[model samples]
Target chain A: MSAFRSLSLAMLKGLLRDRTASFFTLVFPLMFLLLFGALFQNDSVSRSHVLQFGEVAVLDEMPADQRRDLSEALNVEQVRDRDEALARVSDGDADAVVWQDEDGRIELRYSAADATRAGTVQGLMQSLVQSANLAETGQPPAFELASDQVEDKSIKPIQYLAPGLLGWAIAMGASFMSAFTLVNWRKKRILRRLWLAPISPGTVIGARIGVSLGMAFLQTALFLGVATIPFYGLRLTGFWWLAIPLVACGTLAFMSVGLVIGAWAKTDEAANAALQLVIMPMAFLSGSFFPLDSSPDWVRAISNAMPLKHLNEAVQGVLTRGEGWGAALPAMGGLLLFAAVLTAVAARLFRWDDT
Target chain B: MGPLNVSNAAGRPEPGATRGPTEALDAARPAPPRGPAPPRFGHGYHRQVTKNIPAIAVEGLRKRYGEVRAVDGVTFEVAHGEFYGILGPNGAGKTTTLELVEGLREPDEGSARLLGQPSWPRDPGLLRRIGVQLQASAFFEKLTAREQIHTFAALYGVSSRRADEMLETVGLTEKAGTRDDKLSGGQAQRLSIACALVHDPELVFLDEPTTGLDPQARRNLWDLLREINAQGRTVVLTTHYLDEAEILCDRVAIMDAGRILRVGAPSELIAELGVGNLEDVFLQLTGREYRE
Candidate 1:
C-alpha cells in the first residue's frame, strides 16, 4: 500500500514536472474546445438568416402574431436577382433561399456546408409547405407534427460541443500520456528498473491508472468549467454528474490503447506514429468536433466502433439531452469492455525492456 | 547441488586486500557455520533463510535469441561477501547471463539459485535480498537525485534518511536537488547505483555501471564499488574493461562467445596462463585480440 502511494505520488510529480507532457495532456484539448467554441459561437437556431426571392403567400396569410414569431426566428431579406441570391447563399451570406413560384409551389434551397443549419432550414420549409397545402385543401388536418428538444430551447450547439470536446480531451490526454510515458520509460530503462524492484507490476500499473483517472477528472472540470461560462454557453442538466464515471471509463479505454501502443512500439517515434494513426481518425469519426447525424451510414458505422463515440454519446446525453444515469449505462459498459480487451492485448504485448 | 566443493578457492582475494573499515564490523557479526543445505525451494521458507549456501549458484544456464546462443551453457557460483566480475567483450553475453541470473530473463536451459532460492519464475520473496543496477542508467523522469533514490527506498519500505545517506555515499549530495536528466553521465550513473543500494540488500548486481564514465569518474566509481564490496555485500559486476575487472573483482570469469573461458582471480588466471595481464589472458584463452 505504501509502495503504491509513493509510486503514485512520484508518477504524478513526474508528469507535472514535464512541461511538454503537461501542455499536451491539459492545454492542447482545451485549445480544441476554445477553437470549436469560437467557430460555433454565433451559430444559433433563433438567429438563422434566410433570403426571400419573391413574395410568398404562406407568409402573407399567417396570423400577425404568428408571423411576428416566424420573423423573429428567421431574418427574411428581399432580394432582386436570383443569380445574386444564389451567390449570396454560396458565400454563406444567407442560410437558405426561399421563394414561391406562380403555380404556388414553394421552393427552398439550402447549402450543405453547415449540415445543422441545412437540416433546420429543411425542417422549417417542410412544415411551412405542409400548412400551406392544408389551408389550400380547406379540410381539417387529422394529425399534426409537433417537435420539441429534450433540453431547453435556449441550449446552443456549443453545449453539445462541450461534452464531445470533453470526451475528446480526456481520451487524447489519457492515451497520449500513457503511451508516451510508457515508451519514454522503456527507452530510458525505467521499466527495467521497476522490474528489478520488490514490487509487483500490478502496483505500478495501478499507480498509473490512479494518476490517469485523476487527470481525467481535472480535465472534465476544466472543460466544463470553461464551457459553462456565459460566453461558451454550455448548460449541464439531468444526471450530469454521471459524466464523471463515464469519463473515467473512457479514460480507461483510451489508456489501454496507449498501453498497447507503448507495449508494441520499440521507439518514441513508432509510438507517436501509432498514436496519430489511432487517435486522430477516432476523433474525427467519433464526432468529437461535429455531430455525426448527417454523416453517411458507413461513416456512422465506423464511428460506432470508436470508443470515443460512445464517450461522446454518454456525455452529450447528460449535458445536452437531459438524460439520466440509466441512459449512460450502455455506453459506459461498452467503454469498460473496450478497456478490458485492449488491456489484455497490452498485457500480452508488454515488455519490460525495449530489446 | 552438483558440486559443493567446486574448485575456486584459489580465486579468493589476498588477506591484505580483504581488510577494511568493515573488518571489525564483519568480526562482530555472527557467521553461519557450514551445514547440510536446506531443502531446495518450494517449502515456503522464503525469508530469513540461513546464508550457509553460496550467494549465487547457477549450473549450465543457457538462453538463445533465434539462432544466436546469447548465454550458452554457462555455469558459475559466487561465494558470500565476494566481489565477482563477468568480464567480456560487447556481445560476449555478459548482460544476458546477468539477466538470466537476475531472473529478468528466463534461461532456455538449466537453473539459477540466488541465496538458496530459485531465481527463475521470479521469487518475489528473494527480491528483498537482491539489488540490480542495469547497464543503462534508468531514473524516474524529470526527478531530482534525492526524489529518485527516496522513491526507490520507499519501494523497499526503507526510510528517507537512509536514502539520502546513500546519495551522499555515492558523492552525489551536492547534486541532490539536480534533475537526473540534467546531471552528468557520471552523476547519473552514481545516482543509479545509489538507487540500487538504497535498501542495502545482501547481493548487488551491477551491469557495466562505469561503461561510459570519464577516467576520473570511472576511478571514483571503482572506489565506491570497492567500498560497497568492503561492507561485506556480495557484489556481481559485468564489465568489458579488463583493468576494471582486474582492480575491483576478487574473482573474474573471463567470458567469450556466450561462454566462460576461465574463472579465477585475475592474478591467478594470468599466472596460470603465464600471461602478464588480463588482456593477454583473454587473448591466450580465446585465440583472438581482445577488443572492447
Candidate 2:
C-alpha cells in the first residue's frame, strides 16, 4: 500500500521480531512492576484500617479558658496531671501529648519510635496549630489547608511507585535499549539505504522516533494497568487517569534522548556505554526507588533537576494526590520542551554511514 | 563489436562473442538527457532513441572520508538502455563513484544528476524511480524473500504488485518462501535485485551483482540483466569479470585509484590497446592481471 502503512507495518514487525528489544520494551515494564512492586508494597495500604495506639491519657491540665479556645483545633483533652502526660509520651505509652502551654502556645511531644505514628502525629499537630493560628490571626496560610491531595485515602508505596517505575521502565526501553537497535541498522547499512530514499530524512527520523515513543508509551500503560488492575485494586485518590498522558509524554521525552545517542554513536558498544551513562543516574536520582523528599537538600536538588524526578512528582501528584490537569500542565510542558530540543539535535547530527 | 546482432534473440542462446540479448529494444533509447539530470525516465527529446545517452551523469564528482579520497574527480555518462559496466579491482573506488551518482553518498566536490535533477538531496520520486543493489545487501535474514521485498517496497510508497511481479520476473517466485539466509548466493543476488526493482524503477544500479555466484549462476544473472535492459530500462553495473563486462555492457569505464582511467564502448576501449579481448585491454591499462 502506501509508504506510511508499509513503514508502520515494518516498524511494528521489527519490534515484534526482536525478542530482546521487545522484552525490554513491552515485557520489562511488567517485570519491573512485579519486581519493584513486590519490593515496595505498602504494608500500610492493606492496613489502611484505623490503627490502635493502645491506652493513653490526654492532659486536660490547660486552664479552662485556653482549653476551650484551642481544643476545637487540637486533640488536647481535659486531664488530671500534665507532668504524667509528658511522662506517657516519653515512655511511648502515648503516641503524642497535645496541649496548650502558657501564652496560648500549642505544644506536642511525640515518640519517633514508629515512623508511621511519628509522621502522622507530626502532621496532625502541625496542621492543627496552623489551622488554629490561621483562624486566630485572620491571615492566609502558606498552603491551602484543604490541599487537593486526596483526603482520607491512604496509599501504599506500590500505588505511588507503579506509575513512577513504569515511567522509568519506558525510559530504559525507549532510550537506552533502542540505541543498540539503531546502531545495528547503521552497522548493516540498512539505514543508509533508507537515507538514500527520496522520503524526507525527517520522515525517516520521525518514523524511528515515533516507533520508539509508541513503545515507551505502551510500556507505561501496561505497567500501570498491571499494577492498578491486579495488585492494588486500582485505587488512585487524585486524578491518576489524568496523569497518564503526562507520564507518556514525559517518558517519550526521555526516550528521544536515546534516539540522539543512537544517531551519534558509531558502534553498538558506544551506544551501550552512552545509553547506560544516561540511564543509571536518572534511575537513582529520579526518586523512583525511594522518596528523595528526605534526601539531603543537595541530593533533593539534584533529583529535582532530573527529568524522572519531575516525572515522578508529576505522576505521583496525579495518581496519589489526584492532581488536576491544570496543575500538572507545567511539568508536561517541561517534558515537551525537553523532547523538542533533544529531537532537533538528534535529527541534525544523525549519521548513516559512520565516517 | 558495436551493438551486437540480436535478430535471433528469442531462444536461450549460449554465451558467445558477437551477440546481445536486447538488440531489438536498442532502437528505443534514442538520446540522453542534459544539464542536471536528463528529464525523462518517461520524458526527453530522444524518448524514442532509447538505446542512446548515459543512464547516469556525473561532472567533477569527488568525495572524501577524513584523509582518503573515496571517489575523486570522476565524470562519466551511461547511454540509455545500456548495460554499462564499471570494471575495476578491489578498493579501486568503483562503488564510491556509483554510490554518489545514485545519491547514496554526497559528492564533496562536484555535481551528479539522475533523470535530469541534482541527485544528491534527491527527490523521493526520483529515488522511487531508480533501483540500487549494493555489493552486499543486509537483509532481515529471518524474513522470506517475498516478505523482504514487500518490506522494502513499502519504503518506495509503491504497490505490492511490483514486488510480486519482480519476484516472478527474477524467477524466484517458486522460492519466495525461503529466508535470505537460506538462499544460495545466486538466489540471494536475484532477491536483492527484486528488492531494488520493487518500485518499477527506470534505472537499476547493480554494484558487483555477480561477485560471488558460480559460473552457471553468473550466466543466469547475465541473461536476467539482458532481459531487463531489453525491456528498455537502463542498467548500470559494476563487475570484476572483464569477460562478463565485455559480454554484458555496451560500454565500460575502467577505474583505478578513485578515477576513471578510461571510458569507451567495450570494443572501442579494447580497440584502443589494439587488443581483441577485455582481459588484454585491462592488462594494457592497469598492468595487473586481476584480483579475485
**Number of backbone collisions per candidate:** 0, 22
- Which residue pairs of candidate 1 clash? none
Assess candidate 1 and give its TM-score to the true structure. Answer: 0.85
Quantify all predictions' global Cα lDDT against the true fold. Answer: 0.80, 0.69
For residues A1-355, write the lDDT of model 1, one tens digit per residue.
2889889988899999989879988998899899889887877654568888889877667666545556545667889898889888889889998888889888888898888778777766666667567666765442132112211333476777888888878887888879988998888888877877888989998999999999999999999899989988787786889999999999999999999999999887898899889988898899888778788999999998899998998898987678987768999999999999998999899887766
- Give candidate 1 misplaced runs (Cα > 4 Å): A52-73, A77-91, A99-116, A128-155, B1-50, B289-292
Per residue, candidate 1 scores C-alpha lDDT tens digits across B269-292 of 766877566777877777675555
Task: Say which candidate scores most in DockQ.
Answer: 1
Model 2 lDDT per residue over B156-249, tens place? 8766787888888888888888877789998889888888877778889998889888877776777778777767788899988887786676
Q: Indicate the docking level reached by candidate 1.
A: medium
TM agreement with the true structure for every prediction? 0.85, 0.77
